[model samples]
Target chain A: MSDAPREIDALIEMMARLPGLGPRSARRAVLYLIQKRSVLMAPLAQAMADVARTVRECANCGNIGTSDLCAICSSEKRATGEICVVEDVADLWAMERAGAFRGRYHVLGGTLSALDAVGPEELRIPRLIVRIAEENVTEVILALNATVDGQTTAHYIAEALEGTGVRITSLAQGVPIGGELDYLDDGTIGAALKARKSF
Target chain B: MSDAPREIDALIEMMARLPGLGPRSARRAVLYLIQKRSVLMAPLAQAMADVARTVRECANCGNIGTSDLCAICSSEKRATGEICVVEDVADLWAMERAGAFRGRYHVLGGTLSALDAVGPEELRIPRLIVRIAEENVTEVILALNATVDGQTTAHYIAEALEGTGVRITSLAQGVPIGGELDYLDDGTIGAALKARKSF
Candidate 1:
């Protein structure tokens, strides 16, 4: 019996589920839509609906697009032989923003976690292997997050693919470039010291 | 010549125009959708499209809805004879989160801005006055931001409806409980003193 619309409530609920947006922010966003119905809300809604209908995962690389294959996978110009593996879409987005890699990506969806009972099957491990053989991929870059589960998953994948004649690597981990030594915990300092080589 | 789609580029451009989002974030968001087409992107797009088609401004209170009037404006239970006037819907939502008032709202869309040449006509000032008579409004609470423009707008409204005898009030400006008095800026301390009553 509240004054708000059912649709608005649904939208708010979905928005609340998003990272960083809580019930309060969701309500604020919904109210803003109410006021800017013509210029902002309507257009945003339309875009959302359109994307929901047309978007699909790339059959080859798990990338999203309006077709069977994503834009990156479909593009011949991309360095297809080099696959950058990431834990989630968010990480993939971060990589893209950096504009450092000119290759396609493989989204594992998540990492191996014994606590959560997640395994390689839960991830796209088998599919990733199949894609390597199918696409003639040579280099597999592990761009997963620097978390315990993420490292465990990467190690498992590396072990599984040994003797496949494919080169495997990972994103270098240490103290972030702009981080202050005083701010870092003892664990990070030890890891950085241990990992340090010629550099 | 780029691998990205023209539609996607256009979409990114539109997203860049959103508040709190820049070109970089927009690009990242679009790329994310492309990578998670089935799970996230597709659903988001469809929702947007559906909303765009069905959404419209409520003719009565300017809230977004699928019909001529918003659910809040049309509800019988919400006929409390009190209208909370706000500079924008963001403020309205904030008020709703507080859940103190059970009244309907009037979104002015923006504060009266002289520097930007915004006037009563630019905002929904006339519509608000008209609604007061039609809705039998008893109290008109001014919930504008504590800015010079906001105060100017409130004063103008007060003068305009001098004979109507609507109880005009504002949010109390004072030290928030648990906030240290020493930490307060000069303006806040002055306002607190000015607004201090028979305490």
Candidate 2:
């Protein structure tokens, strides 16, 4: 079969490896880019190159930014003595989109997965303990996922900070504000029932 | 909100403009690329740049490749005096993937549409006519979509080529192979039944 040039085919293969795209979708995306080369493809290529050159993990928190320190880490106003620990940078961005937290964050990179051989040192766990004492942080919120590995990581961190004198908290377990009880899984229903409180 | 650095954010925005991607998917893709910088992202960026620098439309058939004449147009075996006409290059690629047709192709760019004010001059209808005589093409296959405008364009092309003595044809309408009859639309069912021949 007559295919696109080698460079175009290579691009499609790389794109198909992305999180949400497959081979078919990547082919469509590449064709669209080729068709709109002047208006879209050229600009996208330039943008990706620019980001590849500048974006880096923050030295303090692991948030992605152009400089060594991310914007949150560099800002003096975000030093609220509260550290929200998340498992991934995507979670950090989700929390930021909510716009309710003024304190800084500590991205763990990933949860402690025994199957994957991920441990405390593999993430930023030791850094979190150090930050709690050095920054005089009073609260360390374990905002990890509800999965087994997430809980294990949170528990590990909590146990490790036994004498650190910092308050530990987690996201409340309950039905989402607009969630229907009928659609919730059994685990979510049980957690919501156990954490029920007075109105 | 704590968005990524400006360049990273720009990259995500540009990615979101692709055919099958939205903002959420684009953000996830960007994060994946950043995480796999050395293995996947850098190579993808370079591939896109290389394609943007070299890929061009085939002057003869409108297929995308690295030179003025695409690979299909430059080949000798494909000059079989038959031309398959399609509305877009993606369709042309689809035909190539099927590996059933060995003749050359003529990409019309798009079908003629009165509502969109697309006339004969806007597409490659005149070019197809010129190629028929110059290339000694004996047959012209109309592979435009089964839409109203597609049919209109086909009829227009057939009439325009009436005096040229080339056999005109089109893709047949039918229940797709492995397609369940219950899920097909009425128009498809009607066409399939009407076109049914000796089993």
| Number of the top DockQ candidate | 2
Q: What are the models' TM-scores?
A: 0.76, 0.95
lDDT of 2 by residue, B106-136 (tens): 9998898878888998897888999999999
Give TM-scores of the second chain, every candidate: 0.88, 0.96
Candidate 2, A1-199: lDDT as tens digits: 2276778888998889988899889999998899888898888888887787777899888888889989998999996599999999889999989888899999999998889998888898888878888888999999999998889999999999888889999999889999999999999999999999999
- Candidate 2 chain A has its poorest 10 consecutive residues by lDDT at A1-10
The local distance difference test score of each candidate is 0.75, 0.89
- Which CAPRI level is candidate 1? acceptable
Could you list the iRMS of every candidate? 4.6, 1.8
Residue-wise lDDT of candidate 1 within A47-88, one digit each (tens)? 655665676667777655689988888888898889999987
Q: Which stretches of candidate 1 lie over 4 Å from their true place?
A: A1-3, A33-40, A71-82, A90-105, A131-138, A174-199, B1-16, B20-83, B93-105, B128-139, B164-167, B175-199
Best by TM-score: 2
DockQ, computed on Cα atoms, for candidate 1:
0.26
